[model samples]
Target: MARALNDGPGRECPPALPFVLAVGVTGHRKDALPADSLLTLHDRLATVLKALTEQAAAVQEANQSFFSDAPPRLLFVSPLADGADQIAAEIALRLGFELHAVLPFDRGRYRADMSDEDGRVRFDALLSRATCVLELSGESDHHLESYVMAGRATVAHCDLLIAVWDGLPPRGRGGTGEVVRLAHDRATPTIHVPVAASDELKIRWSAFDPAVVTHAEDQANVRTFGEEELGAVLTAVLSPPPDEREREFIHMFQGECRRKLRTRIEYPLLLAATGVARLRRHHWRPEIGAVRTHEEWQTYCDACHKVAAVTTPIASLQSWYEWADTLASDYAQSYRSGHVFNFVLAAFAVLLALTTLVLPDAKKILAVAEFAAILAILLNTQIGVRRQWHRRWLDYRQLAERLRPMRSLKLLGLAAPDPPGTAANPTFGRWVDWYAAVVWRGMGCPSGAIDGDRLKAMASTIAEHELAPQVAYNKSVANQAERLDHRLEIVGLTLFTTALLGCVVLLLGFAFAPHWVKANSNWFTLLSAGLPAIGTAIFGIRVQGDYVGSAVRSEQTARVLEQIADRLTRNSSNLSRAGDLVEEAARAMHADLDEWRLLNQQHDLSVG
Candidate 1:
């Protein structure tokens, strides 16, 4: 049975920690800011932070089941630059938010870039106050690129961005304007706090595509940043959207229970028939309530500890991954089994109907049996559809897979990229991306420097824990799918061939001896008609499963992962190269997932 990580031999599991709301800041430096307007900017920043904190508390209280007993936490992400970043960070600190500083360079070099002794002193004071500081890895000569990267990282990590801008274009590569644009591009909600009195404060609510706007000032759906608008944005970020379908999904995810006996029986039968049992003999029997145990979590924790000390964020993410992965496995089994059972039930129903010809005196009984069989198929399909088995499996698996690679990504201070075009509008009824963003915010950025030794360790961990295992899994899947497809084809063809032989025999018997032909007509009819129906059912299942297509895709993916693994081995010490390879491997896996989802989406369980 599955037990919680903290559960003892007989103890119940504890609830998970509450969600975090991360807000980031980017704006003009001290030199660019008007000296007289500093107090106003400070007050505006304070208002925004205070409003978000109150809104977040209300959201968590309203949805107690979605959160833990503890209240939701606020995280403030900033680069702690001389002007706007520091102002926002100070306000956030006063509001009881945890401060996470993302610096463009190490302390000494960064301090050297400050204009005056006062600025440097303030930087040191705030840096000392921060809970975590992530100094990005880069040389002093490439400072501009590092700053741009820092801006991107801030946007990537935060749930919301606060830009203390002056309603103008960027003055340089990593200016406040550039950061705001990055937030717009990534669809991160932003509250634009004007540095001047004339410009109106606005919020880019992330509801429309910025690409459609011809002018910067004319960005689509820019709303005035007021109490009501900020409340709406905060509500949207703190919880799943108000769509009914999305609400249903969240409920199901929270419930996390399954009871599908038909699935348990049907899934194994399909596996056995398709030759998948040859790969794993355990498929011959049903699972005996195998669940993720506490021991399994301990093992994962041990692995993570080997890479680095077990931090709160790492442990939290690992726990979530385990929960999602297990739920995904259960749903996948149930969904796949529903379809397989439909195919078999369809075949059996026809065979039951054909039994009337073989036993004419018991036609009524056969009719009832056939009706029951057909009913079973319909009921199975209806249950699968109403419960959203297929969608839950895909979405939960996507969530789990995305979380799987974060250990490495977090070490290098990288965030997973959102799906293409999701910036405008994410997929309906799918909140996995949103959930992931929230969790990423909770984790914040890694709190240290990225050095050559750390890069080597990350490379080794990825190769051992991620790429190598995935390569093996893909290879296994390729072989299983290829074998199953080939075996099913052979079995289907043999059934049809036997039916032809049966027809030939019936014709010969009719010509040689009419009485004999009439006496055994029922058996011959079954051989000719029943066998063909069974063969057609098998063909339908094979086509719907797309075994051949799966084999090809898995093989190609395995090859790509193997190549990435090789590169990791060659360039283990290069952090930039390792980051790229890790991303490449993740992309390959994501592409494969997209292809698999597309292939099976149209193959919903049906009587046909």
Candidate 2:
């Protein structure tokens, strides 16, 4: 069928391929300068150049790897507005790329508007340094002129606009509409950079629950322009013969499960079918996509997801494969650590439980350590489970996107290993790793180690990820976990305090507590007090279930992060094209409390 269509007349695919001919970055407050207050302009200027060089190299690498071997030429365009522009220009200059500084027509007046003495000096330096300056409109307002000039450069000169917009759409300034309007007006492509200004890590993983992305997939008219191309793809995927390796492996697993065509990619093939069964068995696909109008694609995605859920088993096999291969040392370390921690907790718990039965000493410290260790195991388990789920979705999402012709899923990992002296996950890693290294190992660190009182103020709102519906919807498992965690924290704190107080009360009763009354006047008084204490103990014990705990859902977070990162990865090929869907979803999720009501203005006006 596909062969027939490929040979069809008037419907031939183009061989020219997609390309980004130029790069233009523009933003107010020199958005590319990394949001620092301590740095001088000179210090920042140096950093920005380095940043552009590295980023451009990354861009070039992606282009070379994916689209073509011929390295794309860099066309640096900015107003040269003192910081990012100056750096971009200088970097381009040093890299021997063409620098087209699209300046405002009234560059003199724009220069005049600078009230800051340092800024004026820096601007003067930037202007002098630029390769060439093209003019914007002749306007009185420098702010207005710079923006207009930027708009013009995007339309008149640049092929692609790299908007270093700090991931925010300000009032009439950095909005997508501004870019779209200009792009439409001039018919140029634009790419917004830095993903989002507020995103510290510059990437995040989203739970690619097959169901969620399925709905998105259904809605996508990847065949915006028809079925001939899509049908060709569908036939290729659905009718392809299974690989020989898959066939041999399938017979090994179960002779009858083998099909003539299925033997080729046996591992992934059976794994997908088996994985689907497992995910369903666990009821992990929490949210279902709406029943679709397109039944064929829907069934296809479902089958694909089921087949891919085997990704967990596949990843486990891969993990084992790595262990068997060169990563043997790393795997050995992981296994050893796992066993050591398990042994330590099991021993500690046994000792603590024994002491609880017989000891009259402050042997309770043993229990604290045991409980903390248990919590760590549980948290790590949750994180693992979440990651497993993400791996499943990621494998399929890649296949889905590739098949859909949405965009290619290229990445940094395939080409290069991490450099020395950097943590794997940097932004959240510092805090997460610090806790793992210091606090999470055992309970009760030094007095200096904890700021218990400081945590009290923020206790009610512990970075409410649940309130963000996208996170909640996409990562229901993780959201429940985060909620359970927060609840457990309260429970853990209460129980620890209660246990301490109980020991103290027992101690005081044995000695000084007799002061209030000739306390042993009646056994009834002691019984009455003991009854309430027992009740409190029971309540605390019940609350501890919250700490017995929810899974970490880290995989869900990682999957979601991959989706976010994938957006950036796609842009390296088509530098001017904007993927606003991700930006909107992210902003909608990340928006704090204040933006909601202001953002929902029409509702109240309509209701009132």
Best by TM-score: 1
lDDT of candidate 2 over 1-608, digit per residue (tens): 22233234654321111122345555445433554532443343334434544554554344331222334445565666655455455555666555655554446766765646666786777667655554433345445534653554443334334444444434575343364345423323233334333332111111112123222112221222122332232222111123444323212211111011211121122223323212221121111211121232344334333322111111221221221221122222232233333333444454454554344365577567668866766664454344332222222222222121111100000011111112221111111111111111111100110012222211111112111322443455455445544543454456456656755665677686665435443333333343344444333322322212223333344356445444533443221122232332233332321132133222210100
TM-score of each: 0.86, 0.26
Judged by whole-model lDDT over C-alpha atoms, candidate 1 comes out at 0.74
In angstroms, the error of model 1 at 297 is 7.6
lDDT of 2: 0.34
User: Candidate 1's error at 120, in angstroms?
Assistant: 3.1
TM-score of 2: 0.26
Off by over 4 Å in 2: 1-21, 30-72, 141-146, 173-608
1-608: candidate 1 lDDT, tens digit per residue: 11233334543232344678889889888998999889988888888888888887877776565555565778888988888888888888889998888888777888888877878888898899988888766557877667776787788778789999987887777678888887776667889999896677888855644344323355675888878888777776777656766666665565564333333546666667565773243332223233333344455456656655214367777767766776677777787778777877788888888788889899998889888988888888899888788888888888877776776667666444553224445322356665666566678777877555655766776777678878998999899888878888888999999999988888898889889989888888777888998899889878877889999999999999999999997898655577678878888887898888888877776665
Q: What is residue 460's positional error in candidate 1, in angstroms?
A: 3.9
